[model samples]
Target: MRWGRTPDSAVTERDDDGYADLRSYAAIGDGRTLALIARDGRVDWLPLPGTDGHPVFAALLDAADGGCVELAPVEPYTVRREYVGPTNVLASTFTTAGGSVRVTDSLNTGISGRLPWTELARRIEGLEGRVELRAAVRPGTCLGQASPWVHETAHGPVLRLADMTMAVRTLGAEDVVPGDRRIDVTYVSSPGSRQLLGLVGTQAEPLVLPPAEELDAGVDRTIARWTAWSEAFSWEGPWSDAVRRSALVLKLLLHAPSGAMVAAATTSLPESLRPREGVGGKTWDYRLAWVRDSAYALTALFRFGLREETHGAISWMLGSIRRHGPEPRVCYTLDGELPRGALEADVPGWRGIGPVVSGNPAGEQLQLGVYGDLFAIVALYVGDGNVLDAETGRMLAAVADLTCDRWQSRDSGMWELPETRHHTTSKLGCWVALTRAVELAEDGHIPGDPSRWRSEAERIRSWVEEHCWSEERGAYVWYPGTDRLDASILLHAISGFDRGERMSRTLDALREELGCGPHLYRYSGMAEEEGVFLPCSYWMVSALQLCGRTREARELMDALQDTPNDVGLLAEMLDPATGALVGNLPQALSHLALVNAAITVATTS
Candidate 1:
């Protein structure tokens, strides 16, 4: 997307107050942490040290008291940027009448065994005649609670906040004199002139600050490493470039030590069209992990030839399953611990949406579809000829037994709402899990009572056919009672069950009852809460493709997947009528479904 021109000289002349416009923001983070950098050159939303840490930069909370780091051009310059190559290394080109500058930023890769440090490196090379630049450097501590002391050293001056130390290594700036949690400096660069600025934070232990030259070398090495990683991807598909980028983003979001992938790199961005709600209570600290996304992420990684992430996430999931028993929590922290349930924050929501939340309340909800999701992940691995170990086999059998016992019960289903129902999709999930488990057992991949599993699978299928189907509407209802059409039933269609004339009739009924302008809502607007679920709409494409309607499926897929933001990132929900992004951002499930839908259409066609 195009970016706004740099702020007017006056705005840059002082520490500007207020939040950065949503359109101007970009994200960067280590796998374990993330930072939001706006086009105006402010690092506004970093959770220092780790994803779960309190913000060292809390502009996402109360823009006034929330801290940030500012780096910007001195004069007016329009901005445009993208990740460098396929890596998360961000490059922004700033252009003005006199000259231009391209600034690259990233958190340098962690060494195999090295001290912890957060690095921000800025490189500026003049493009034309000359450009005068002004920079204001500020660092906040503990959610803007304490001011760091700045001291001048021979290498450069250091900014220390309690035990954490940030050493700035550069040649062309004045000393870092403190002012209201801010530091100011100015510099000028002619054509071909360059400058490198580095910020490194270290713990209270005896620290050895690397030399400026070594840090420079480290930046080059980090880029090279990212390049090699991208080059190793084995993806070959119609959306290979997009898939590769998504895979890279997934990689960047993966916490390697723990084998968890975060839903997104940011929190507190808004779902409503209103920008004010984008700030506080609207915030969902996505730094945690969800089991549903973990299974899907594992499959996606495996598809792109990243076996390590696949294996690691599965190992983590299995351990979690063993610990929590047959029923899995909807999500957990990176370390696989249960959440304390969702709570409303006293802080204002993102923008103005009230109740910035910490832990997800979905953790306690019974999303029975999770059974099938876990089964599908393991089934995919086994289908690829991988062996299932005894421990993992027990986990699969337990999941199957749980499905047999609870499949008929009403549940929150995959949506995680408060109202429970004998959701058609939940029963279908049980069918899927049992069906796959039987297949694995029959193939001697897992030790299970195949006859019992087959009987349970048939039982679910029979119940869905008899009860969930609607003779009046000529389709399957959202739940057992309501005639309201639901987009989630598309899951059943894609799962290879009941692909008969009746299923076709249901697809047509869905088109009329629940379909929006071009997309499909999760269900009719009769429900007071919930935005249109975008991923379910995409699931329609997969269903249609699997049902032998390739042309319609491709058309719908094109329309639905085209609704992402400029950078091809989708939110949790999109306005069915307006196609505007609503709900949470860069949703992993949405994108994962997109990739899978594309794959299905491509292969089947």
Candidate 2:
């Protein structure tokens, strides 16, 4: 039940300094945590207990002292990788001179979903002539923030990492040797032979080290559940393959317990390959759940008819905001708590970019765009014939009233920079939020003053048309006074604020200024600072279709759809010239944008 084409993935190679490309990694996860496996069979990033905390295999962020578990060929080999079917489970084949072996990797789930303890299983099946392979598991020091040590006992080797204890187990291997920083094993694979390595751990509870064979069976069981879920997915639109793949990637990012989908699995991957002297830090922790991201995630989930995830996400978002707000934080923790700002850890970032961080700086920003993000999802939920409880309705009504008051105030815009200028995108977000709130009140879904909300929305429209639109640039400038451009204005087309002549011209202006063909910088002056922002590129695809340029949208989408790495995963940004992935791995916003763009084009046309 494999998905995608023949897996002739990249020819395996590392950088001169020994690191895999950001695009060369695939992800597998249980409901609670995620693990990244490089195409060359290295488990480089895994956060035990949950997706929000510190990781054992933090090599993706810190190549030095950031531990990794390697299960790769001993001899020279070429490799290819893909998810096992539409599942998060990854299977990589290493073809050496002697033969080949298919290593299937998974973080096993229980019958009822997430296991009480973390279990990582890597099962090897020989496919051709005998091939020799090496395996090593080195627990990290939490990016030099905590101490980790391996203890050899009568039973086996146990890792005491921070407050957690991990038991590493192996079976059907020819040799096993243990060292201080790592545990190493060597195995020979003959045709039709099978072997396994499994790690079981718990943070506070006792370890549940199941038999190695049981771990192998767990991989099969997880695959079966993923297949059932994929078969149930509903997407008949154009580019369904890419849409489906994006959905699967988003599902992996969703924290099942709290229903809070993280922004990305791994953080501290640099957005800019090289930092500029005046540039702000390009590395930040994105493990926090952003309201904007979840807003797009709900839309993507609804388009697929995924009722459980749709409802789960909606509940988590509203519940968190209801508990924590009069005004919402830009993002929240996976467990529904406020986050401390991104605090730098003692590790060099990917490619030696320093200032790797925990937590996220955005949690403190006042991104007025979130009002639009929040109201849009709730409007969709109620429109689908779902009834909101009185508490949520009242809560939302207050939020709408607040939006009317705050619409005129300047705050950080969608990009969440430190700047507090009167950004055009912020004004448009408030406009969309209030506009939807009035509709909800008119429809009896809420108890807000529809007249007041409607007036504010119109006023916002007038203000933006007067101030944000720049006649000199023949487009909506970044704000009122400057000739700068912002790609986020593309969202206005999707929001129905402006899909006419002006927006069409702005789209052209954006392409001419911020875009190199379909590859777009997030805003003016960011061109030399970062890679093409992946989500901004997809937003333009939606803008194109909504602005009556269907042919252009489809053609651009066709070129970009096949650009995801061999495993159908996208990073936050990519070097436009080199096509090298940059920023965080498997970013949820990137995938969400892809899903919504494909769906918008298909449904609108």
Candidate 3:
């Protein structure tokens, strides 16, 4: 299962362009926060203290000022990276002309739950001959607002920027130099030698440094926890490895304190790798949790036999709605508060893409899809023999009532487009909500007027059939007035909205119009404009399976799985032409779709 060259093989060196490809990065997390590690042995994107907190190492956005930590050989080398077994611990092997070294990276976690403070541990082991290692830490503020200063501490040298402080500890290093806004360390190792470098971060609090041995032990403990978690996954289906990896990625995005799952780890990574002049305004902050994304993730987790995460997420969603208001917002912070509105960053974004955003504006949009997402998760929960409390039942009924009143109105739709319209997908989502609510009421799972809910559901079905279907297009249009096609309607087949020939025809239409190879655009006219949406491609896999195209479904599943980076991780989108990863890394929706699609292929084929 090892990758890269053997000890006897002659190795050559390759130079890195300083800017690491998004696909060349792997993620490690402790359920509280996450850090992105490139194959070149650098920690690029980390939101210290909290997953939703401001970034301390955002080199993924602005490499110069957006902080980073590098601990690799000063000379160029080839890298072979992969996770340690099924755990989130990432191991990267560097092969040079002189020797080879293996570096293991992890965001330390405990067996009980997330640890109190954030810590990133890197352990280097020399495989053969002698190797020289260099390490550096450059601290940057949130969106290039301030630079860190070295503050000599009793324990070690601490990097401080405003209220944030981070302590760095090293083992077996020759010298440690503190530079302006950075710390540099150099060391040498012989065969069978090991060294540990650890960084612990805190916000406006006293920095406590743990012993090097203790921090090193934390890496082993974290790996054990991840292995134990992966062992509990009950999936023995197709693409089991991919499914488990996706599950692990999804777990990384979960805020254990609040049981809220964020949409992605990093925000403002552009949707396209093209120049900023061409694709400047499309960047957004996705650190917040969307009701739709969390709902879908919950459903996928349930299918994987993960009860704790499923129930935890459901409880969080219900509690958040109750705490915020009766109506569901498009998105919320990990703690259930509405996002503070969009804030533009001063620094250039990833690859010089400008206007890096901090907060999401979609929270204010009325996306009717939230109703369906909420009810759908509840339906799956209740159907799995779980009981709902009276308070939750009342909340569900109130949501149903709200859906009945708003089903006829215009909305921003699932994609959160600006122009409001009676999006067919929105109407269908309302139909799903009311239909599930009526079933829950009839089954005594929740208190509601089943007859009224059923009436509205039937009305929506009739309205969509009359207005949304385009006879000329031979498939469902994006809306009543537009003849455009949307990839989202492919979910109707899985939702039982229309499992007959019409949905099959819709699947074909989507493939012909939106499909690029196996990947697909979110909607029409997105071909040359944006990267292909990864989740939509997975949706096509499920849609194909439902349409009796089992062989094609499996083929598409294989193609979709192949699209992940070398480490088996998917971003939100992929460059249609170059296949480079675009948008946020470790996208929860993309992983969720992969898990669900694998399940579909297993069950159908």
Task: Give me the candidate number with maximum TM-score.
Answer: 2
lDDT of each: 0.68, 0.86, 0.85
True-vs-predicted CA distance for residue 331, candidate 1, Å: 1.0
Candidate 1: give its CA RMSD in angstroms: 4.1
Off by over 4 Å in 2: 1-12
Q: Give the Cα-based TM-score of candidate 2 against the true structure.
A: 0.97
Give the top-scoring candidate (lDDT). Answer: 2
What is the alpha-carbon lDDT of model 3 when measured against the actual structure? 0.85
lDDT per residue for candidate 3 within 321-379, as digits (tens), equals: 98887888888899988888888888877777767888998999999988998899899
Report the candidate with higher TM-score, 1 versus 3: 3
What TM-score do all the candidates reach, one by one? 0.88, 0.97, 0.96
- Residue 29 of model 1 has an lDDT of 56
lDDT of 1 by residue, 1-605 (tens): 11213332222311244654444455665566666676666777776566666566667555665567666676777766777786767777777777777767776765652226666666666667666666555565554356566776676567666566666655455344545445565556677776666666666654457765656666666677788888886767766655676676677667766887676655555554443422332345566777778766766676677777787787877787778876876777778788776655455444545566666777778888888878887887777567878988877877787788988788997767688989898888888889999988888877868888899899888888888898999999878888877778887777788777888888888888777654666777622343466677777888888888889987887565456543455666654434555555556777777777777787788
RMSD of each: 4.1, 2.3, 2.7
